[model samples]
Target: MDLLTPDLGLFIWNLLAFLILFFILKKTAWKPILKSLNEREKGISDSLATAEKVKAEMAQLKSENEALLAKAREERAALLKEARDTKDKIINEAKDQAKLEAGKIITDARAAIEQQKMAAITEVKNQVGNLVIEVSEKILRRELSNKSEQEKYIKDLANEVKLN
Candidate 1:
């Protein structure tokens, strides 16, 4: 029974010690502990707020990047269309130039053929005139071959004149 029971003097001494320790701890440690707890709470709240702000910024950046990608795609399509149009125009122009060159070549060939035909016609006419002159000279040379034949012909012409 005595072991389980506190003595009166011991109780009074314990009460005094408890009162002193409470006062010392209240004076020295309470404010620092409460301030540290508040600072820790504030730090946690700031970190959470910063995280949320970063998440929002990241979302905005993602949206902006998607928009930029879309714009780049549109620009690329327009550039491709323009390049195709330019290529078609160049091809058409080249075809037109080729056609013009072919026409010029054909016209030049026709003119050259006409000039050759005219030259051949002139050569044939000159040859025919020479041949006619040669035939006439041969006939005239046969007719005037002998002086005795010319005298006999003159005597026959005189006899016919006297009979008439």
Candidate 2:
């Protein structure tokens, strides 16, 4: 109970000292503390704003990258398709040329075979005609040895011709 109640004179002295200290701190420390706090708050806010801006730019760049990738894929697909078409066209042309060459070869072979057959037939006929002429000449030489036999054979041939 005694410690809880202070003397009036002591209370007055303590109040006076507190007022002096308060005024001194207000003039010297308050402004600097408040200014430092405000500067820290401003710096924090600026950092947050910069982070948000960077995040937005990153999102935009990501979208741009996706668009470029899609375009590249489309171009690659088109190029592959064109290459396939070109390959097919070249293969078809080669096949068609091969067929033409085969047909031409067959036609030439047939024409050559026909020409060889005709040449064989003409040679056989010429050989037969020459043999017949030689046999007839030999028979005539043997039968018509003198003029009397030739005249007798001519009379017999003329008489046989009249009867037929």
Instruction: Name the top TM-score candidate.
Output: 1
Evaluate model 2: give its TM-score: 0.68
**Position 119, candidate 2: lDDT:** 99
Expressed as tens digits, the lDDT of each residue in 6-93 for candidate 1 is 9999999999999999999999998999999999999999999999999999999999999999999999999999999999999999
Candidate 2 clash pair list:
none
- Model-by-model lDDT, in order? 0.86, 0.87
**RMSD for each model, in Å, please?**
11.7, 9.4
Per-residue alpha-carbon lDDT of candidate 2 for residues 13-106, written as tens digits (9 for 90 to 100): 9999999999999999999999999999999999999999999999999999999999999999999999999999999999999999999999
Candidate 1 lDDT trough over 10 residues, lowest sum: 155-164
Model 2: CA > 4 A from native: 1-25, 144-164
